[model samples]
Target: MDERRESPGQADGAGRHREGEALPAPPRPPRGEELGGGGFAAEGQYFLKYDHSSYQQFRSWAPAVLFWAAVLCSIRFPAAAAAERSGEESAPPRVRVVIAPTLSYGPLWIALEEGFFRDEGLDVELLTMRRTAEALPSLAAGEVEVLGSHILPSHMNVIARGGRVRIVADKGHHDPDGCTSEAIVAAPSVIASGRLDDPARFEGLRVATDKGMSGYFYIDTLLATLGVSAEVLRTFDLPLSSKEAGFTNGAIDFSTAAEPWLTRLVRSGTAVKWKAVEDFVPGFQSGVILYGPALLDEDQGTGTRFLAGYLRGIRRYNEGKTDRNVEIIAEATELDPELVREACWISMRDDGEIDVESLVGYQRWALREGLIDRAVAPEEFWDPSFVRGANEILRSREAR
Candidate 1:
């Protein structure tokens, strides 16, 4: 092996200098200048050298060292920041993760307030986006680091468009009933017509959807099963937040949405639950953790650290022994604590671990829904190494 020594005053990103350079001799003070030297060194000695040749040599090596130093600093910043940020503290790697504001997003809440994210070295800042679709695009565009949102369709569409994103982990899957995120609802007109008692009555009623959203696919699947065709139910593009009011105000006869909007419509009596998507598609997961591909590809170390922290969070979240976890979720999601508790019962898994079965199911749904032109393999969208590493970390802790 070639033996190379690092020069004195030469530092890496961690601020560690080499012992290769020569030390300067001690100097005598002029008179009584208050002795600036510290306790470690004698009164007149200087820690740094000020020599012409030495300075020139440093300049020669400085550019390359500085370049690599920056690279290392970028990689090390998050870990260092994570170390400094305690549960109640803030740090550089403390990412501001945004999730849709709803009861379904309770697990993220549990992770944050329970100190799971902090344990993972993340200073999580959870924000509730009224519309996840609208929010996810920003994450893809590098406006944010992580987002908790529906994994299918939008995630696929993003990948198709060449956005650097991957579904590293999953939150919850469709219940045993096969319902995923959206619940099918009929407008007051359809519900009040008493025709709701008759399945054929919905044939000609207009239904509003986000057009390309999972809700749209849920409605399509429901209609196809019932022998209803697209022509029978007029499909209109509508925003989810606006859908409830539209259905109640007689603008549309049917619509699909996620809770608490779905719950709100049912509670307010503006609409009735027609069907849950999980009724047909079982083990369908929702709310995935995504990061830009560039980060993973270019900065492998930082990317690894990020995933390690993420998995650490997952490990902490899996220890759900009581309602304390539920309360954490409630506060994070800003939903009523009672509603969160109820939602938490059906929601599975708090960690960002991927459910293989659910991912395949979702990919199948996207394929069937024509969201993607061709059948893209599930692995194309998922990177399992991170999840596996997280599992290993947890297993190691258990072993210890």
Candidate 2:
């Protein structure tokens, strides 16, 4: 049989240490240490030195015990380690979007209907206000998080007033020879006299729009291109809701308008098409995405999430034949499907990219006409980061 050796904590022939290795001595007591029992004798016997009346001795081990206990606890438990490793939470909050009832917002409806925001873990509520100007004030007041109804001049006016609104994305750009949803509507009398071809026709005509808005800018620019000073035409400031009636009642000889109103005017004999915006300013980006300084301060994640979700919807809507998407847009806009289909096929850039060049042109003309204080830098106005992020999401989904 093999012989076993004793270890430091055991008696000879019973301890766990190897037989050839020397055992370490037990730790020595401090000077003047009291002995609870007499030291071990040569025969391995122990005896108490103190009488029964005396107090029992204690070891000075509180600090050492606590140190070792902490080490042991850390080794056995893991939640503390995990707590140190994880950083702050990054979950995004809900994004409230303000939109208009214009045809340019078709993409947003498509995105909502297709559940793209849901897929991206975002909660988006879209509220359609009556006009972009109203939405701008609400956005400035923090009542809304995003605005998609902001056209160039309205945004510029806000900036001029020292508001910190910035364009973060594009809606749709105009296409050449496109069936423009925008029309410079004229009275039947103006159309009958061949004023549509006469550069001098608008010299004395009063035109109405939300003053200092892009609608006004577009019409003014068209007149300027015809060598007619904007000062020559009587410019009227009218609420968008009043535009159709204003045109029909002869309150204004002409006015600029977007869809449904244009459709209404055409159908109801209130307005005649004097000019198509696309014919004069092809590739002009109509609607834009905007956010005020408060929104930019509160969260960037919300913006990213909204864009990602929105882009996903765009891709889904454009998935196959555009006709299906057009039908969907028509329903959302409350226009005849055929009219919506015709407008969709013509008005929007086929590729869904906003025309930056056209915007640059619009700005130049606005400066020349003195609509804005000065020519705002293109970089100062538009923010494409959200658009880029949205496009990336689309590309990634396509890959999958």
**Winner by TM-score:** 2
Question: Per-candidate TM vs. native?
Answer: 0.66, 0.67
Off by over 4 Å in 1: 1-94, 135-137, 177-182, 192-200, 298-323, 342-346, 350-370
- Supply the TM-score for candidate 2: 0.67
Give the alpha-carbon lDDT of every model: 0.56, 0.60
Model 2, position 43, has a per-residue lDDT of 11
Which residue pairs collide in model 1, if any? Answer: 8-21, 94-123, 177-278, 178-278, 178-279, 179-277, 179-278, 179-279
Alpha carbon deviation, residue 191, candidate 2 (Å): 1.4
- Residue-level lDDT tens digits of model 2 in 106-196: 6676776566666666555555444445567667766667778646565676676767677776665556755667878888877787866
